[model samples]
Target: MRIESESAKNQWVTAAFECMLDGGLRNIRIEALARALGVTKGSFYHHFANRAELVRAAVERWELEGTDAIIALANREGAPAERLHRLLGVIAGSSAQQGRGELMLFLEASDEGVGDAVARVTGRRIAYVAQLLEEHGVPSGLAQRRAVMAVAEYHGARVIAAGTDSLPVDERVLDVGDAIRFLETTLLAP
Candidate 1:
């Protein structure tokens, strides 16, 4: 569409993502988003063909935000370890609600309509991690293994952080960054 219209579309997609993060898929109603945006359902319809289309757009946006933008930043910096450190730091600062919302998105990705897009994003992550490891002088096979381990580490850390209430989840998240840093130093160091 027109440039101005595209901005509205982007705003709607961003609002849908926020809805997902705040309250899962159930919170992504047109009326709710319209109210949050100080607009009307007609505005949402103008941007999206239907609710499913909106959901797809939101997921696509989230995937790009989580992967592509971060990768671009890492590549631009030319310091793999430091880039990864910053990435993990961002992850560690995320709220428990965000972790839950991410888990929900992963589950929803299993649906037939969304599966390919999610899988593509995930595969891209693994490949990117493997490349990073390889650049550290790791053999290809080992790099691939370590890449998977890295992803597992992130997921495991989030799972652990989510399951505990004895300490604040944000406090637990600090351990995740520390744990990943340990892996970087001991296992992934060049």
Candidate 2:
């Protein structure tokens, strides 16, 4: 594989993402991607050593744009409780955009070569959420547990919403709020 300009590499990464969005990561083939971009497989090889490398880059891009960036925005100059709400809202909005079915697809695909990259990003995201919870007066250990629970709830809600098409964004917000309240009252309270 030969080196290419960063813009060309980014374009390949973007093409890979579109392929994933269309049919999960398995559908992302060098040949297909090249065909989609009106380029040759040689062009893809110039940018990525192999499919794994491309998958890793695509997953890294998703994590940076989707999870880490949203959490950062949520934490910007806000009260602890407000920040938590904003963070939950960000999850809710993303879930709504993804729809429940797509979330399952994403989670399944994350377990592939892309999974490690996703896990790394998710770990950082969880740590950030835990820190925010600690700042809001939760104990450090409990904050960490709550952050994990929050991620679980987000995934669970996506599943639930997918099963029931009628589940609204407001309902998802309420579910997240109730979960936060439970954590506060049951775990965080003295």
Candidate 3:
């Protein structure tokens, strides 16, 4: 059952991500991850040097797979507001990116290494949002402020959406227009 190769590294990282979602980083023990994946430490060490390396790799992978992917989504197709709206559309509790997992990841930002990664992701998201706003003649400071606010609201909306426990994740589409209007349009309003 052991798949020996770089794919093993990816499997380990993916397992680590799921473990982190289950109980944050502390639950991501090598033995436990192996148990969860039905692998062994031998399989793990074949990919990562140690637990710390695994943790680092997990965060990097999450950064690339989550925030970077979202930013890339935002950068594609349509105007800034439309792009932002599309980004919000998928996150409105419809995806893994929209629930307790992300909150846990944000909470884990206190960890030194993870903190740097978290900051990098958050800053990139805000900077990208701000860039879109700035493109519309919004002042730099206001654009930045709105961008931060937008992110906060985005998370808050997800919390509320997920809290209901009634809507299927895919059905939890928070209105992207609200975000676009507040974050993008209002700034452009004369």
Name model 2 segments beyond 4 Å from true.
Answer: 1-6, 95-111, 163-190
Q: List the residue pairs that clash in candidate 3.
A: none
Residue 161, model 1: lDDT of 62
Q: Record all residue pairs in model 1 with backbone atoms less than 3 Å apart, i.e. clashing.
A: none
Q: Rate the local accuracy (lDDT) of all candidates.
A: 0.73, 0.69, 0.71
Put down candidate 2 lDDT per residue, 1-190, tens digits, no spaces: 3334667888899877666655556766888777767777788878788898887777676777677788788878778777877776676555444543246446666466555665676688778778888987888998898879867666666666555556664563556567556644543453
The order of the candidates by TM-score, greatest first, is 1, 3, 2
lDDT of 1 at 1: 20
Q: Rank the candidates by lDDT, best first.
A: 1, 3, 2
Query: What are the per-residue Cα lDDT tens digits for candidate 1 across 1-190?
Result: 2224548888888888988776556567888777777777888888778998988887788788877887776677656666666665665566777877766677666662677777887788788888877876788998888888877776666676666577555663466556656877764755
Residue 105 in model 2: lDDT = 43
Residue 169, candidate 3: C-alpha displacement in angstroms: 14
lDDT of 1 at 172: 30
Instruction: Please tell me which predicted candidate would have the highest lDDT against the true structure.
Output: 1
What TM-score should be assigned to candidate 1?
0.83
Which candidate's TM-score is highest? 1
TM-score of each: 0.83, 0.74, 0.78
